[model samples]
Target: MIDVLYFAWVRERIGIPRETVTSEAATVMDLVDELRAREERYALAFADLSSLRVALDQELTEFDTPLEGVREVAFFPPMTGG
Candidate 1:
């Protein structure tokens, strides 16, 4: 199982801060596909991948990043300086 964390609006949309997911996805995009398939809330939260940033094991990564042995995956909107 992998810990999946959602932040900001993503969390609000999904109605949860985090979850444990059992997945066979090889890449972040693959994992997203699985989540998006689970419910409409997930689909809405992940609707625009371009507006989102991802982190694997607390290190920023791309959607194509491999998920092998990763213990955590976090999704949030792109950060901006105030």
Candidate 2:
């Protein structure tokens, strides 16, 4: 199972802070397809991949990142901090 965390507006659309998901997804994009298929909230939350950033096991990653042996996956809007 992978711990999927939703931050910022992504959490608002999904109505949850995090969830543990068991998936056979080959890549992060595949996982998004699975989640987006599960409900409308996910569809809205992941509507624009361009506006989102992802992390694998806490290190920043891309959508094509593989899921094999992944322990965590976090999704959030691009951070802008000073």
Q: Largest TM-score belongs to which candidate? A: 1
lDDT on C-alpha atoms for all candidate structures: 0.98, 0.96
Cα lDDT of model 2 by residue, 7-53, tens digit = 99999999999999999899999999999999999999999999999
Q: Which stretches in model 2 have alpha-carbon errors above 4 Å?
A: none
- What CA RMSD would you report for each candidate? 0.4, 0.7
lDDT of 2 at 30: 98
Runs in model 1 with CA error above 4 Å? none
TM-score to true structure, per model: 0.98, 0.97
lDDT of 1 by residue, 1-82 (tens): 9999999999999999999999999999999999999999999999999999999999999999999999999999999999
lDDT of 2: 0.96
lDDT of 2 at 31: 99
Judging by lDDT against the true structure, name the best candidate: 1
